[model samples]
Target: MQEEKRRGQNRDIDLDTLDGQIIRALQQDGRASIRDLAASFGATRELVSHRLRLLTEHEGLRVVAALDPGFAGHHVLTHSMVLVDGPVGPVAERLAELPDAVFVSMVSGAFPLVFESRHGSVEELHESLDWVRGLPGVQRVRVTTYSEILKGFFVSPERRQISLDSIDYALIAILQRDGRTSYRALAEAVHLSASSARARVHRLIDAGVIRISAIKSGGISRNRLAIGIGITARGGTEPIGRYLAVSPAIDFAARSHGNYDFVATLVGASSSTLLTVIDELRTIPEVGAIESWAHFDIVKEDYARTLGRVLGP
Candidate 1:
């Protein structure tokens, strides 16, 4: 029943069309100009511009800057599954309100609420989890601490540590709010020349310190099924982790130390596509077992963390 509803909602946005192509292109490079996008699609600039406007205005598309976890001083990444005593709505709402909660959703399976959170240290991560376990209607919480995040919509696996000054921090803060902030505005905020601001922004992007891309306002995707998978590996986890990380079907993959050796989030146009991916996973010799869950509703998906809060006043 839930799957059918999601399929109906997904049909609203067809990815094979020009709009979908534009979105995919922008996801790679959000700062692409309208002219560049139109040229790539062999479409008129006016049409492309109109479609872009429609996507941002009505289609829940948001172009923003996704900061590297290390750059943001976040070292701990965790995926938690919550089993509620009674109603799951209230518990889910409370979890979604947490500042550290990057992704929150209600899912099918033993756990009704699944959320992902980040912390600056292991102590902070455990403290946050303890608080969640004490929340009203919360029964038990199972957490998987990620040793390394391979892929995510807002997080880049490439960690290029760079020395950032006050001005760089300011620029990052501004871009976190809006990735497409004009060079002039960025210059004014950081008190730098427009050209210098542009140079710094480009440098940061090139250094992999930050990623500017399009992120959907809702869950990972409104037009696809979002499924979470937990895998137990036979040998070492590195090989299996690398394979899942590189797969196009799996957007978010991580190596973790818990019940599952690796956890991955798969997005597909239909259940059959997701099933095919699962079957392929089963065929892998290293994969010993797999646990899968479908997300019924995504309550929150926010990765934009305030630099001031992270860096302190």
Candidate 2:
């Protein structure tokens, strides 16, 4: 990650530990043998098996190889940052009600609300933006177009283990938009026959390139509070980012080039604990500036939102 940051690029998660082994292996090839992961971790398969179960039940982690939209013809991937002064729940709720909205956050950054809003086409995107631009509490929205995605996974970087092909890239882009793309249709799109396409998709699955699955969004815990924190690091982002990544309360954290330099998205069980976490973050020597935002409700959560135009059946 440090090397990637030096190059102004991103490093995929590392997958070397027992837990990382389980997450990455299962994410790409869901049916991987515990014995194999255990061997990689220098532990017994039973122990690895137990750890895997805990990761699922306790962490609520899903090793999903979600679809890519580019191949299925819904190619646009748009991100928007929003700012709001007052209660974000009301506005978040209203926005979340829309099936098209995805990945909503109330953070203390350049954009209070960052979304992976989608569109089937450029014309359609502009049309939808017309409505999103008018949403209440949305002080302003700046949209950025993502032409390509180098990497994405639900689990940490340590879990992303796979190789890709030209076809895999094209297939992922399509599946990002249309998760239900059939093997036959995929073959036709990528200039392969049905059999080859099916084999390639399965290989990509084993290699950890893409996944075909359903998108469900009801995992919110009433005990969990979404707290957005921005930390400015003096030594560099890696140390602080690693610190936040291992934190029990932190849910989604990233090193960004923006107002705070680094952002940590955490899930606090209670308000007091959340504040305590903030205090701890502030105490870190490298931290220069820290800002936080608390949310009462989450508007939207969809993995496919990255491809843009999140839609429902």
Candidate 3:
């Protein structure tokens, strides 16, 4: 292994123990201030801020606020599996450009590209998929609609009854791009006083309308094994879903109403560790059968939303 250089010289700034800890802390609270991070890391506030800036500017790491698609006028969320007759790269890129696409990736398995999309209604989703199926290199498309979201990475499960105006939408759009943006900047972007902008952000967070968390950069090495596991629950999926949610190896888990009762993403340092986690899942009495697929490469992963259409003028 090569010795990693400091100063974020290249896209390969090695994540040391401190860096990992900082990331975990940010995942828990992306809006944490420099003083808070410094206290947690036992470092000076200035040092902590410098490190964070280096990661964001050079290593592609970002902190972003995630919004509930439903709250943003998207009532339907769908998971799609796409098979391409020709090159997968071009097909995957085209899928990513779809307005409703929330997440898209090229994987190793029965499907070459898998993506999650959000829509305002069933008709909209269908039309989007119809256009995708008609794409030149497209061979087939498999769709699985999410009934209820058990967990959505960084988003809260609870729904807010709050109504939003243009100001709120503008603020959300800014945060979606950079969750670490300063209060002064947020106010300037949305044309509000800094104090008022700060207040509104807290209200949104407390209302469970949105959440902020650190996003791991795509430049990060894929040396570690990454897999997607589909699970069939014997009874109600609550128990199994809860169990998987707390597992350290599992990054994403959710209850679904499709071929599987639940779906999860797991990452481990090695194949053995990955297998070990799967073996543990097998031990769960509520788990019936499990299917696993290794992730080949993540072609495009974007969580940002186009608020103008959904939020409306």
User: Against the true structure, whose lDDT is highest?
Assistant: 1
Ranking by TM-score: 1, 3, 2
Cand. 2 TM to true fold: 0.49
TM-score for each of the candidates: 0.87, 0.49, 0.85
Model 3: runs farther than 4 Å from truth?
1-15, 43-47, 219-225, 268-273
For candidate 3, report its TM-score: 0.85
lDDT of 1 by residue, 1-313 (tens): 9666545544454444677678777777888999898788766666677788888898777788867777778899889999999989899999988888988999989998899999999999888998899899999999998988787766664666577788888888888888888999999998999999999999888777788888665444545578999999998666687789778888789889887889998876678889999999998889999999888888887777777787643
RMSD of each: 6.9, 12.0, 5.0
Looking at model 1, residue 112 earns an lDDT score of 87
Candidate 1: residue 282 Cα off by (Å) = 1.3
- TM-score of model 1 (CA atoms): 0.87
Better of 2 and 3 by TM-score: 3
* Range of the 10 consecutive residues with the lowest summed lDDT in candidate 2: 7-16
Q: Write the per-residue lDDT of candidate 2 for residues 1-313, one digit (tens) a residue.
A: 7554433321232322455446545544454566676666566555666776676666554443454444324567565567766776676666676555656655545556666655578897887677777877678766656543323343223224555567766666676655446778989999999899878767665543345442223333433456766666787655676677677667556555545566556655467878888888878888888876654334566654442332221
Q: For model 2, state the Cα shift of residue 45 in Å.
A: 2.2
- Candidate 1 lDDT (Cα, 0 to 1): 0.82
Model 1 misplacement above 4 A: 1-16, 220-222
